[model samples]
Structure formats: structure tokens, C-alpha cells
Target: MQRGGRVDGATLANLAGRDGGSGWGLKAVRDVHQGHRLITLPSGCHLTYGANDDPRLLALIDKVPSELWGAKLALQLIAQRLQGGESQFASYIAELPKGFPGIPMFFPRTALDMIDYPPCSQQVKKRCKWLYEFSTDVLAKLPGSPEDPFGGVAVDINALGWALAAVSSRAFRTRGPTHPAAMLPLIDMANHTFSPNAEVLPLEGGGGAVGLFARRAIAEGEPLLLSYGKLSNDFLFMDYGFIVEDNPYDTVQLRFDVNLLQAGALVSNVSDALGAPLDLAPRTWQLQLLAELGLVGPAANPELNIGGGGPGAEVLDGRLLAAARVMVARAESEVAGRGVERLCAVDRPLGRDNELAALRTVGGVLAFALSNFVTTLEQDKALLVGQAVAVPQPGGAGERQLQPPASEDEMLAVRFRLEKKKILSRALQRVGALSQAAAGNAELKQTAGSAAAKKGSKPSPATSKGFGSKKP
Candidate 1:
């Protein structure tokens, strides 16, 4: 690795080895200022797609389909590792971790079933299943048996998983390079942090090296960090075998069945302003509403806030508000074709009550979904304080030993849940208030109507009629 910029006394080593280094990491010998170059990986030293000159590897790659291109690269890496000193990637391969810890592929069935989040667990299962399929269908078709190093055996699912994880965590999508994605040597050693102190920039001009420059000042002996972009915990765990505690960018997805919503619309008294009930099926109606708001399918995940204008604002999200409007309009029998702008207007011509009612319904739904996941903060705090699980003793002993403190995974899980819980709880309370305001307004109107009816029914002292009746 060559120093790309004015890097002063920086070296690559197992920075995390003391704490159980997962692999190689970079460290600073002296204090490095912001913008100081840490390392540069020369072009020839890196591995990119379609760069392997080996005829056998290229032939194998040609046989593999484009969709499974990543798998082909993984197989190539394994083949080179088997080649030892003769392989071009010997040094880089040696530095990589033996196996990626916490990758779902390596997880046992029992462990897989233990994942708290259903989405994450489902994803893990899907990935593992796909990998197994590729191994059987694709690898089995290749020449030679399991004993052959350069042939089929090199594509073992387990070995390929290691390569997959390494490439995923380390590779960069470079523009000026021959391959779509390339793996840099020293540049890949930097660990990920949400807030990074350095950035990996592709060197401008036609040169091959990519520069790792300090984004900010780094104290001596501090490990350099890079951002892997903002990612949620579920994705992070699935892809990187780890989760960030209380990630600000994290959110719990709430999925709704369009069919169910449509079914409700059919039987419900809710209708548009014309007083006609929804003509379409509940699912179709939901789609129409979402289509109006441009939230068809995957676009449905809206950033929820306690109160929202936009993402960081105090007002609620516009998309959510629009959805609430549609629900209210349908319930109140409001007119069709009213867009989001009209619905969200402060002085909307009509359907004000409908908006409030919608807010209540939507808020209730969100709260219920949020409450189902994660333990209460109090419960989490108690667990963190001191929770123990009994484990069977060795040699078939009857007694069970209590292990102090929860596992790291459990701790991280609770912490992540606690953060999400806070957001959900706050938003629930706001929605509740909005609902109550709507209810209170309806009650006030009912009381006023009653008083007016009573006054109208009362006799006008029988004065005018008495004039004619008394005279007769």
C-alpha cells in the first residue's frame, strides 16, 4: 500500500485484535489532521470484475449467468486462495477473515428461528435458500467432483458465503475502473461508523490509485472509520452481520394488506362526499387512494413523526396526512378527485371532521402495530440491569449454571427496540390527541343542536293565537 497523500506515520495492523480483531484495520501513529491522506491502493493491486487473466477462471465465469456474476467472482477468489503463492491475490486473501461471524448463512436453524424481527429473519432465510439453490443447480453442472480445486469444489456454499460477505463489506462501486465494482487493499481495512472521520475518494485524472483521506482530525493511535451510508438495523445485520445501536435512520416497517383494507371499505358506512359508498373493492379502493398519493406498493413506507411538516419538521408527513384524508373522505362520504394539497389545506372547503377522524384511525393503527414489537423501556432497563439465563452444566450434571449479564446480541436488540419504542410512543400520543379533538368537536355540535331543538319546540307564550281564540 502506497501513501496517496501527506499521511504521517500511519500503518495497517490488527487494531481490533486486542478486543478480538475481526481482521486487519488501519491505525495512526501520530495525530493526523483533517484531509490528510491515509493510504492509496495502486490500480494493479486491487481486484475488479473481468480482471482475472486466468483462462480457467474466465471460462468458468463465461459459463455462469450474468445474474449470478457475484457468485462467479466469489468462486474465482476461492480458486486463487487455493493457488497459494501463485495466486495474484495471495496477500489480500491472507488478510481477510477466515469466516464472517454472525452471517445468517452460517447461523443454525435454532438461531435463525430466534431472531426477534420477522422481516430480518425472513430475509436471512431467503438469502440462505438462494445460495443453496445456486450451489446445487449451478455448481453441480460444472466439471469435476468435490476434490477438484479449480472446478466445482471451489464453489462450496460455505466458502462462497465468506467471499460474499467480504466483498459486500469491502468493495466499492468505482466509475473509471474496468470492473463495475473493485476491492481496494488498505482502503478496505477501515471499519464502519455512522459518523466517519475519513472518506475513500477515487483518484481524479487517469491514475489507478484510490485515495483514503481524513475528513477530520484524528488523534494518535485512533482507528480510521468510513461511513457505509445510512442503513437500517435489519439490513445492516443481514448484510454486515451487525447492527448499529439506536441508529437515527432506523425505522420499523408496518405493512398493510390492501385486500383487508378493501374488505373494510365494502361493509363500512364510510363514503365519499356525494354520499355514495366506495364503489370498488376495499383493495382496489386502497390502491386508488395510494395511487393518488403516489404511494403505490413499496412507496408506502412513510417517515412517521410525532408531529410533521416533513422529515425533520414539526408537522406530520404529507403522504400520511393524505392517506388520512382519503380515509376520512371515504368515511364521511366526501367527493372524489380531491388531491393531497386540498385535503391538507388548513381551511379546506369541506371534510374537516373527516380529516380528524382519519387521523384517529391511522394513529390507532400505527400505535397498535408499534406496541406489538419490543418490550417496554422499563422492562428493557430491568433486563439490562441484570438478567440471567440458566445453562446446562457439562458432563450431564443435574444442576444448571446461571450466566450473568445478557448476551451481546440480546443487549443490542433491547437497545434498538427501546429507541424505536420512544418514537412510536410519542407519535401515538399525538395521534390520540388529534382523535380526541375530532370527537370533542362532534359532541359540542350535538349539544348545540339539542338546545336549539328545545327552544324551537317551546310555545311562544300563546300570545298571537290567544288574541283570536279569546275573542271568539
Candidate 2:
């Protein structure tokens, strides 16, 4: 071990051999710490869990209404499956109708996911860093963990959510795109302390792995802390519920991990099924669909079952995040159209043939798509960052590649690749939106065509290009 001490658990069973720790990268944990992790035995190194690890964690998981033993078992299986290799089991349990009990009072998020933690307090981030340092410093001084079959990080969460907080996350192994260096479940468990005490930034490569660090002085017994990364200001707001920012502001961290993306898809399906019959317009329904899709809220995330189905690929396929792009563009188009219509209503002149003019149609499809697609571009770029960090697929998987590893050399590589991908995907996304533009043009043609169809009718040859791209 290090030099200071180690803490062992005395309660419940030690599921994962009552070992030091049992998430993904157990090897790294050992290598990094040299066997002196300083923490106690968790009854088991579960890949995922149901409600709690043991009865002591809270009242009783057995008593909880849901049948979750199966899931808990699955978590253990994933751990065993990926044991010695880089694999993590991400899971959760949310029974509280409102919110669970407090988390700080328990083991801390050091073992959970970051998105699960509070809004990521500035102080927590600082304190968490100090705690991690403390954990390392105490390595030698502490005694070996008590050999309790049921003693591990699994059962510390209290009846009130305060005892422990778990963050849902994607699995990472050293071999995959989410290498151990980049995906630190250990750090992830700690959550975002916000004080900058601990940070895990991408390594020197333009798109390589990440580097974990301590932001402050550490103690001898405190838990090691980590971050969830910078998020958009609205964070997961657009996914979970209805909270839109007047002015777009970004959070220092990303709101959801790849896990949320999956959850959102499920939620959207459910919400649309239930809410679709309410007789709402597509736009109104589309906004509601965002929450179902997990773009709005925090709790919308689901428990990640290891081996059940790994975090879906990072949506590198422009098509995967396409609907989001289309929706955002459409919204923007609507607004722009309104403005144009105001101008048009004032009897603006369009005296020439084959000439472009503003539209009077307020909710024209093309205008909406343009706006929606424009907003989605930022989300797409941001998501690209997440996708870049996601599991890599084959080169032939799609039209583009994830930005190459984030390296100094790779940055240029990434820049070039990104430029090409942007051109391709943007053009693709734009072309996809063109259907709406076609509709808008047709509306104009109908109005203008009516005039032309009557007299001096030389049907203006339909143009294939956009008003924006035309050489004025």
C-alpha cells in the first residue's frame, strides 16, 4: 500500500472477496495504489445492484416492493465477467416518490455516478479532492479491512438517500474506447466536488484518454473524489423536464453520461405513448417528447445493467442524433418565418421572377427545420465530445469517425477530421431539413405561381439551392 492506513468494513458480506475495491479497472486501482487503497471490504464488488447492498444500507431491500434481486445478481455477474479486465457495472435504485434521503451522510458518491449527485457543489468538489488525497496518505497507517463477508462499499447508503449516492454510468475497460485512463469509476463514484480539488481531463492527445488529478491538499482517511466533467448550464434539463434557458449558458460539466442518452430514449417512448392522444400539436408534443427522451431531467436516468446491454455507442452516426437536430432547426425556422412573415405582410416587393423572397407562412415546415437544426448543431458538437469519449466502432460503421484521440498531434488530426465530418454531416443534416425548405418554397410558389399561372406565366424554373447559398 501507500504509507498511512487502510479502513475495513465490519458489516455485511464481502461479495467480491472482501477485497480492496471491485468496480472496473481493479487492476489500475491496485497498480495506482500499490495494494494500499486504504478502503474497507464491500460485501461484494457488484457490477450493479437493486435497491441496496444489504439491510443495513437502509431498512430492507427485500421489503422494498420491487423484485430486484435478479438485477443485483446481474451486477455481480458483470463484475465477474469483466474481472481482471476493464469493465464496470453501472446500476441504481430509486424508490422515493420525490427524492431519496441525503447522500453526503453516507459513503459519498466516490463509488457512485456523477450525474446522480447534487447540482455538483463548488465546495463538494474541493472537499472531495482533499478526501482522495487523505485516502492515499492513510494507506500504510491503516489496518487491513475486517474480513466480513458482508462488509463492503455496497451497504453504506442510508434509509435516507444521504448515506450514499450512486451515479449511473457507461462501462469502461482499458482495451475499449473508454480506456481505464479515461473512464475512472473510482473517481466517478466520488461525483463532482466543484472546488476543483479533483479533476479528470482528457490527456495531451487531441482525443486520447484522460488524466486524473487532485486539486488540493489531501488527508489520511477521507475518500478520494472525482468529477462528472463540465456540463451545459441547463445540463440535462432539456431531457428530463421543462426548463429552458432564455440565453444559452453552458454548465462546466456535461449533464448526462451515455447512460442518460439510453434512458431518455426509453422515457420518450413511454411519454409519447401516454401523451400522444392528448390532442397536442406536433411542436407541443415534440417539446414534451424531449423529457421522455431524457433531455430534461436528472432522475430520468435508468439503472445500467451490466451485460444487459452496454451503453449504446456514442451516436457517432449523424442519424442517431438527427431527430434532435431536426427538431431544433424546425423550432428556429418557425421563429424566423414569423419575422419574415411580418415583413411580408407589410407588402414587401418581390417584383421579379426566379427571385427569392421572404415568406408569409408563419409555421412553414422549412423555416422550423432550419431553426431546429441550427440549435441542434451545438448539441451535436457537444455530444460529439461525449461520443469521442464513447466506445469506438469500426471505421466503416458510419460516414465519419469519432474525432481522433485528443492529442497535440491528434488535435490537428481531429480538426481535419472534424472539418470533413462537419461538412458531410452538416450538409446531410441540412439536406434532410431541405424537405421543409422545399415546402416553404412550394408555399411561396403557390402564392407566386398563382400570379404567374394567370398571366406572363413563365413558371420560374425551380431552383435546387438554398437562399443562403445562392450567389447574391
Per-residue lDDT tens digits for candidate 1, residues 118-207, read 555556666677678766776655557433446444356776678777776667666532344677776777777777888888776756
| Candidate 2 displacement at residue 57 in angstroms | 27
**Cα lDDT of model 2 overall?**
0.27
How far is 292's C-alpha from truth in model 1 (Å)?
2.1
* Backbone steric clashes in candidate 1, count: 18
Q: What is the TM-score of each candidate against the true structure?
A: 0.70, 0.22
Q: How many pairs collide in each candidate, listed in order? A: 18, 110
Q: Per-residue lDDT tens digits of candidate 2, residues 139-175?
A: 2222334422232333221211221122213222223
**CA lDDT, candidate 1, residue 141:** 59
Give the residue spans of candidate 1 off by over 4 A.
Answer: 2-8, 13-24, 51-72, 145-154, 176-179, 258-287, 295-320, 330-352, 374-381, 388-423, 429-472
Winner by lDDT: 1
Global lDDT of each model?
0.55, 0.27
